[model samples]
Target: MTQRREAAIEKTDLTPLAGAETDVAPLGRQGLKPPHELTADEDVDVTQWNRVAAMDEFKSLVAEKRKFIIPATVFFIVFYFALPVLVGYAPKLMSVKVLGVVNLAYLFALSQFFVAWIIAALYVRAAGRFDEMARNIINRLKSGRE
Candidate 1:
């Protein structure tokens, strides 16, 4: 029973209703019937794998990417690279007299973490919203309506 069940699951139909007594019948083998290809009835169907559909998808992908790449590159340079350098180098020049007790470098270094947190928050929000907008535009264009 287990062997029959395994065979039924692994191989194509060999049940009694299929009129075949063997489950391991070789298709188009020597001295056997030939393997069949798709008949006439199945060839009349049409779908969107043609050249026009492929070109449309490629163009949509490119347009969606531009909405994200330019602004992100600018933000990465300013917040990640330029800001840190400015902080490290211009400590004395950009000192803040928060109070008589606290100096500018001390305040800046201490609040570096706050600046980092704000930048990260802005990035996450912009990324989520921008991706949604891009996807919506791309989907609209794909359907040939936008």
Candidate 2:
């Protein structure tokens, strides 16, 4: 009787349908091969990965990124705030006409948008170099593992 009850409970249980079979899966290895790659293996070189993470080249790449990003951020902050500060403090200068009723303040404010776009474009270009550096590091690690 108890065996029948247990069998019925197992049959009615919905746990298998409620969740994925695997709790966790590996990253970047689920059929996401790049164009240059033919196939990916499940093997992982954890030590090599840790070594690559600690490499000086990797650190320099990060530093190079910060070098551009930090200054750009500071410059943008000051440039963005300068117009409002000038307008609030020196209203006369800000109100002066630059181009037939277009005030200097308005021109400066408008230029901010262009400046931001230029900065973004420049970062995109710079990011290419960063990507190359990271790829080189990864390639080196992969080669060393073999």
TM-scores for every predicted model: 0.36, 0.66
Tens digit of lDDT per residue, candidate 1, span 10-61? Answer: 6675443322333344555555433343222222222333433456545565
Compared to the true structure, candidate 1 yields what TM-score?
A: 0.36
Worst 10 residues of 2 by lDDT: 35-44
Highest-TM-score candidate: 2
lDDT winner among the candidates?
2
Cα lDDT of model 1 overall? 0.56
User: What are the per-residue Cα lDDT tens digits for candidate 2 across 66-89?
Assistant: 999999999999999998899899
Candidate 2 error regions (>4 Å): 1-49
Instruction: List runs of model 1 lying over 4 Å from the truth.
Output: 1-69, 79-91, 94-96, 130-146
User: How many clashing residue pairs, candidate 1?
Assistant: 1
